[model samples]
Structures are given as structure tokens and as C-alpha cells.
Target: MSNTDHLTALKDKIQAVEDGSIVAITMPVNIYLQEAEDMARCARIDIAELATINVTEVQIDDLQARIGACREVQSLWVEDQHKANQAEDLWADIQVQANELKSELIHTFRYAYRKDEHLMSAIADIAEGSTNSDTIQDLNDLSVLGKGNTDALTAINFDLTKLDTAADIAVNGADALAVANGSRQRGSDTKVLRDKAYTYLKESVDDIRAAGKFLFRNEPKKLKGYTSKYWKKRNQSVKKESDVESEI
Candidate 1:
């Protein structure tokens, strides 16, 4: 029911990736936030050099804004995932009952329409697929088919009210599950925007690091502040493991 057009719009404006690969968070988001904070701090080392490339105080403020957006959206994603999970459980329960009803209708329809070529063909089409979505849609199709051919059902003493029940079940279940599915879909959309925000922040951080590294090329102490300690440790840890593997 909730509109996700805004989320889609935000993601498009970011243009994070051309290939559309917004996946699991690459690192803990807290680390990304801290990295942004540290980058912002180091950018102050030589604001003049950064300003030469238009990476001004306004850009720095925007970087913080992007970080804040990522943080807020990340919390909302957690809530959405929980809601989706609950809906999935409800859908599973409803599907079991729906499937049983569909099977009952199939067997009865075969008997009621066995002598009629046209009706049998319609029944055949309805009995085709084997998925939850198929079950939901079949209920709708069956309701229509049943109502249009009540004379056939009446001769067989079929309960016409079941048609109404079938139609209600189909409509209600489909509407509920559609919203749940929309929530599931919004998961990726939310991540796309969240991931794009991180990309935006990292781009600024990289810009600041590049300038800082170049400006402090002659000063090792200031240069340390320009680089990512997280990556430095990770690389060292990885190299240590590789060295042990080579020794083995």
C-alpha cells in the first residue's frame, strides 16, 4: 500500500552503479560512518588544497548528510525485513488452505465437465501450473469459470456458494500477499539507496584522501591521517594469512 516512488527516485538521482549491483553491505555500516567521520576530520588538514578542486565545506556538509541518510534508511530496512518475514509466515498458512480448496475444485470440475469439450479445455488450462502464485490465480479463474457454467454445476449438485468463497479467498489473499511482495521488493530498493548513500560518502572520502595524500606526501605523520586505518589493518591481516599459507 505504501508508495516507494520516492525511494526509487533517490536511488536514481544517486546513480551509484551502472551495472545495478547493490548487494549486501560490504562492511559494517558503523565502520563506514566512522570512516566518513575520520575522512571529514582529515580533510581539514589542508582545506585550501581541497578547495582547489571544489571539494569545499559545502561538499563536506553534504557528505555528512549522506551518511545520516544511510544510517536512517538502514534502520528502516531492518524494520521492513521484520514485517516481510511476518507476512511470509501468514502467506504460508493461507496457501495451505488455498491449495486444498484448489484440489477439491479440480477433482469436482473434472467430473462436472467431463462430457463437455469446451469446459474441459478451460479446466485443463486452470490445472496447469504448480506454484503458490498459480494457486492464487487459479482461484480467481475457477470462480469465474464456475459462475458462468452454473447449469453444469447445478446438474452435478455442486454448491454454488463455494464460488463466492473461492472469489473472496482469491481477492483477499492476493491483496495481502501483493503488499507483502511489495515490501519484499522494497528491500532491494531500500538497499540501493542505502548503498548509493555509502557510495556518495566514500567518493568524498576518496577525494579527500587523494588530496591529503598528495598534499602531505612529504609529511609521514599527516599522511597517516589521510589513509584508512580499517583497510590498512585488513590488508595486513590478509597478507599475514597469505604468508602462512605460502609457508604451509
Candidate 2:
């Protein structure tokens, strides 16, 4: 399905399921889905036997559709998440550079206004806040302050073009930061949708597993097909760690 169809199905499924746990997503989505697919295949083979509990062929087809929706949504979510992460990384680097330049310009402003109390107070206003957004605004403020008092800066041998650079950095950094924040929000939104799709799928999977477990309870090999190997190993590892901690 196209991403739009996946997203639409995601919304509908999310509305259809209102009580799924948001936690215990222990394994990666890809690995968990692979195990689920294996279990689903087993369930398909034993579906006739699963008739006692009403796990019909219709349910199996529904499970497959849910899986497809999840796979497509998962891919989109991962792409958005990667973009958000990259944007955040770039923002951090840009913030560092902007802060460094801000520090330089603030120091220069202080030196240029050292003998003038009125102008020093202006410098104080420009240097008030230290947040990323505040720092970007300060760059703009400093550029204006420097240009307005170019004579004093020139007397201190300041290059005029540095003011232009400060103004440009302020505009560039603000635009980049805005884009980064928007990307992060998009990633967060997509993650919630993906979780909903997962839950919708888990409902079908667990229902089928419940039936399979009951049908194959007398046969060990058949019973194993209904279980989750990924979760079993994860639970075992957690229990082992807990045991060691208790011993300590």
C-alpha cells in the first residue's frame, strides 16, 4: 500500500483499538514482525484446527493486511525518525557555532563600550539570555548594536563585515532550528501512529495464538509454533539479570 493508505488505515486501526499498552516494546519492530509472521504462517496451516475458537481464514487475511500496513508505516516512521535525528544533530552543531560566534561578538561589544555606561547597558540587554533561540536573537541584536556604533568598533579595529556575518548567522540558524523542531514533531507523531498499527496487529496475532495454544496443548511441537521466541529469549535474559542482581 502507498504511505497515504497506510496512514489512513493506521488512523482507523488506532481508533478501532483503544486499550493497547504503549510499553514493553522490547525487541526491534523488524525482528518482532518477523517472528509474528512465522507464527501467523503456522496459524494459517492449523487454521482449520483453530475453528473451535473462531480463528477463521478471514482473521488470517486481516492479520496479513495489518502486517502490510504496519510494514509500510514502520518504514515511513523510521525514515521520519532518521530525518528528525539528523536535523537535531545538525541543530546541536549549529547551536555550538552560533554560541561561539555570539561569545566573540559579545566580547567585542563589551570592549567597544567599556568607557560608556549607557552603551554598556545596551550591551547588557543584548547579552541577557543564553538559550538557543535567545542566542540567535542576540546575534541579530548584536549586529544592530555594532552597526549603530560602527565608529566605536572601528576605533577598536573591528572588521565591519563581522556584523553582516552575525546578522546572516541569526537568520540562517533560526530557519534551520525551526525546520529541525518541525521534523522532530513529525517523527513523534509518526511514532504514535506506528504504535497504534502494531497494537491492532497484536490483537489479531494474540487471538490466533490463544486458539493455537489450546488446540495444540497436548502436542509440544505444535504448541511451540504458537509461542514467541523473541519474547521468550528476552524474558529469560531479564530474569537472568534479575537473578544475578539478587545474588549480589
Candidate 3:
């Protein structure tokens, strides 16, 4: 394959692994071994069939190098899957903390307001437009408006404005908390796929090793012996020459 094609294949494999579609390690050993051998055989045939391409040794070396670099990137990326859970946990904790603080603040405000009857009465007077002049009420009492007390009215208006502002802020903050909580939930949902990918990829290494041993148990076709050497040589050859990188 061309360098770009090779890298694309690797990317597709990694994506499949991450998305929980690649089941290389989950298949029966015999079947996996058979598929692997078939792939190797086809690869050899394809290389030999490319005899008419007029390909040069330098070009082959460069392609191999590119493939090696792609592999290094794939390895690093797969290894980083462990961090997915950490992020999910962090977002969950943040959501909890945010919600707790919001609830506590709201509860405290309600408790304080309910405990103070004078404060509530002032608010009620403002709502009902009560102007009983025989009693001296707090500035929040709308009677201050009838008394032509602009200063007290302004202060009451300011307090009312503050209440409105506080209500708006609380609403907006609740919405934000809901969104944050949703994000944490979504992250938790995708965690299963990530976990499966990590488990499958980790076990696949041992599975391949076992398959190699099983394949070589009876015969000496040298296929088992050449697995590492063949891929190493191919990588080195492709590195010396390659094509323009392509997006996945």
C-alpha cells in the first residue's frame, strides 16, 4: 500500500478500536489467527504484484518511515485512553459541586426570607400597593411612594431590581448547571465504549502472541518467525520515502 493508504488503515483500525468495533482480541483464537495469516499472505502477494509500478528503493524507504511514525502516534493515542475516565470523573464532581452550591444558596435565601416577617410584610406591601400612613413601615413599603420619598422609593426600587436581578441570575445559573450535568452524563455514557476499546486493545497484544505460538506449534513455515522482522523491515523501508499525508 502507499504510505497514505497505510496510515489510513492504521487510523481506521484505531478508530474502530476506540469506538468498540474492532474486536481483534475478542475473536476465537483460531479464527483470529486464520484471519491474520490470510492478511499477511495477501500483503505479500500484493507487494509482489506491484512489480510493474517501477517503484524505487528510496520511495519504499520513505513510505516505511512514514508508516513507522504513524504507528508511534497510534501507540501514544491508544495509551492515552486511560485519561478518558479521569475526565469523566472530574466533570461529574464539578457538576455535583456546582449543584450543591446552587441549592445551598437558594435554601439559605428562602430560610432567611421566611424567618423575617417584617421583611416579608414590606415585600407584601410593595406587591399590594398598601399605603397605611398611620404606621411607619420599612422603606420597602410602597407607602414611601405616596409619601413622596424619592430616596426611599429609589432604595426600594433598587432592592426590587436586585431581587429581579437575583432571580435572573439564579435562573441562568440553573440552566448552566443543567448543561454541565448533561455533559457529565454524556461523557459517562461514552465511557463504556472507551473502556471496551482499552480492554480489547490491551488484550489483543497477548492474543496475537498466543496466536503466533499456536500457529507455529506444529509446522515450521517460518511465518511465525518472520512476523516481527518482516514488519520492522517494511517500516524501515517505507520511512526512506513516502507520499503526501492525507486526512483521516
lDDT winner among the candidates? 2
Candidate 3 Cα outliers beyond 4 Å, as residue runs: 1-159, 213-248
Best by TM-score: 2
In candidate 1, where is summed lDDT lowest over 10 consecutive residues?
Answer: 1-10
Query: Which pairs clash (backbone N, Cα, C closer than 3 Å) in model 1?
Result: none
Worst 10 residues of 2 by lDDT: 15-24
Model 2 over residues 1-248: C-alpha lDDT tens digits? 55457456556756565545654565689987887788889888887888767778888877777777877778889999898888888788888888998999889889888998988998898788988899999999989888888999999899999889889889989988998999989988778878877887787777888888888999999899988888789899999999999999
- What are the models' TM-scores? 0.68, 0.88, 0.31
In model 2, residue pairs whose N, Cα or C atoms come closer than 3 Å (at least 3 residues apart or on different chains), thus clashing, are: none
lDDT of each: 0.76, 0.83, 0.41
Q: Count the backbone clashes (under 3 Å) in each candidate.
A: 0, 0, 16
Q: What is the lDDT of residue 209 in candidate 1?
A: 76
By TM-score, the candidates rank as 2, 1, 3
